[model samples]
Target: MPISDFRKKKLLYVFNVFFDVNQSGTIDRKDFELAIEKICSLRGWPSGSPQYTKTFDSMITIWEGLKKRADSNKDGQVSVEEWASMWDEYAKNPDNALEWQTQYLRFMFELEDASGDGTIDVDEFTSVCSCYGLDVAECRLAYQRMAEGKQEVTYDQFVALWKQFFTSENPSDPGNFIFGKTKF
Candidate 1:
């Protein structure tokens, strides 16, 4: 089955905010490369450093896995339709998408949890969003809604939100704010 319009909107937010870094209207290896560079830069990992090397390798592995799973037409790029279709499947049978999704989620959690304290505070969430060029104020509000007045969100909590972001189409789901504001 195809994804609902609401679900597609949420998925598009994730795609545009994270995957389609180059704004190329499609997801490809270049987007993943740019993502690695952006993330490494945000973490202050100089290109020759071990951190940069490990991040680069991990991102490449993620890209390879995404392309293999989502690039259904063998076109070397994932179009919007392809992305929507992939998520549709993920929404149905999560295990089919678990491996790459888990890796990606861990990477994102690490990026957002700047203090390395195994949890993400509202400040860290806002800071990461600000670094990503999102509005800090809006990010704070979104975090409030996502955390439901909690001071911090642990990795397991974030994992639940991540799952909701991928699987739920309900308008009230807090996971919709996982990427900050959504269109609907």
Candidate 2:
């Protein structure tokens, strides 16, 4: 489906948050967590909250899935260069934006599957946090929540939470342009 203009703007805000850490127009592993934290804060979610844990797990899962597809070199890590390359390739397709978004979700799924075993465990969740620069305490909280019955996060739940957290308070304001849409 074609993303609404609002969703496009919202997604853009998210993309910028992830891509422009330090406002340097460049993103690295360190910046990734900052971006995630920023999104969490904007959406009224505490970084270490159970709600945040589920959302973060979902995102990591998607990232890992996308990495498997984008990391053609099989290096086990997707660098900035690889990300750019993937984006470029996707942009050339007729359904460029949609494909980009799909890839993004897939990547998150993969990130959550830290063990590459198609399932996310507490250890795998923590490993994702470490990759994104989360400290031990923060990572622990995430696992604690999951172990306490939070379980795995589904794509729809993740998307709903993302919309709630990232969308601007002013319904009509059409806020930040991070990912390329507001309702993604």
Candidate 3:
């Protein structure tokens, strides 16, 4: 099914408002750099730290994917129109969206699974949520629901959350909390 116009609008709003942290009116490499920097600072992972280097690289890789998958005009930034086009296509074919989201899910999971134990505990969850400017409290609840009493989140579960966060329309769904404190 084609994604509703409203859903597309909400996604775009998130990109324009939160993802475009530099207020550049478009999603670009600088915006991504600023975000990664914030994450590193908050985590106290300074330059040369393994986590910092890995996260920085992963974010850059993700940004590259966004450019390849969504930067239609290919002018070096993802304009609203380009984003809309990619999302609209994904809305029409959710599987296509998954193909794009899976890589991100793996990289994000690696970044957040700080323990290196292959599981995502509450602290890890909180750190990642905070990085995204999401409400940690709300995400706590969501994480509980996802983990379902498990101490760690499996990669399969992480992938499922990625799918749900982007594809589900019900705002109350736990996956909706993936972005943290969304206005919609």
Candidate 4:
């Protein structure tokens, strides 16, 4: 089956609200730079600090990978159609996910685990969501759903949900809240 409308909307949230950091209609190098700036700012990683430099480099690497996979037209931007289509292909054959895709997932999980305790607590989840311009209250609820009554989410559990976020079509899947609740 093709990508579901449900999945598409979630992907749009990522594309429009997350990756398109400059409110641009397409994903490009600038967006990645802005995102790096935001993340570093949120963490108070001053310029020239190890954290800042690492984040800047990591985001650029991720941008290169995303551009390779989604910039089919080679127009220097990844349009919404290309973004959704690339993900649609991944949804169909999740086991074939590229290293970059898994790398992105790991990066996001590490980003949200602010305490660095190997698990994500509700507070940590809400804080990162806020950094990304997501609704904190809604994020709290989403975190609860994702944690499934647990006090924290382990990296292993997060990896499982990450797969669900990409591959599952079920609306009730907790992984739908990976980035925050999707508008139905």
Q: lDDT for model 1, please.
A: 0.85
Best by TM-score: 4
- Candidates sorted by TM-score, best first: 4, 1, 3, 2
Residue-wise C-alpha lDDT for candidate 4, range 1-184, written one tens digit per residue = 6677878888888888889889879999999898888898889999999988888888888889999999999999999999999988888877788777888888899899988899999998888887887788889989988888789999999988988887777878888787866444
Write the number of the candidate with greater TM-score, choosing between 2 and 4: 4
Model 4 TM-score, all chains together? 0.96
Pairs of residues clashing in candidate 3: none
- Model 4 lDDT vs. the true structure? 0.86
Task: Evaluate all candidate structures by whole-model CA lDDT and list the values in order.
Answer: 0.85, 0.49, 0.73, 0.86
Overall local distance difference test of candidate 2: 0.49
Best by lDDT: 4
Off by more than 4 A, model 2: 1-17, 20-30, 74-77, 94-100, 103-184
The alpha-carbon lDDT assigned to residue 109 of candidate 2 equals 51
**Tens-digit lDDT string for candidate 3 (135-166):** 77876776776665677887877777666666
Query: Which tens-of-lDDT digit does each residue in 83-161 have in candidate 2?
Result: 5555445434524344436655455555556555665555655655554445656555544443334565454544443
Q: Ten residues in a row with the worst lDDT in model 3?
A: 174-183
Model 1, span 48-137: residue lDDT tens = 899899888888888888888899899999998888887888889765665777788898898899899999999889877766678888
Q: Which runs of model 3 end up more than 4 angstroms from their true locations?
A: 13-18, 94-100, 145-151
Q: What is the lDDT of residue 164 in candidate 1?
A: 87
Ten-residue stretch with the least lDDT total in model 2: 174-183
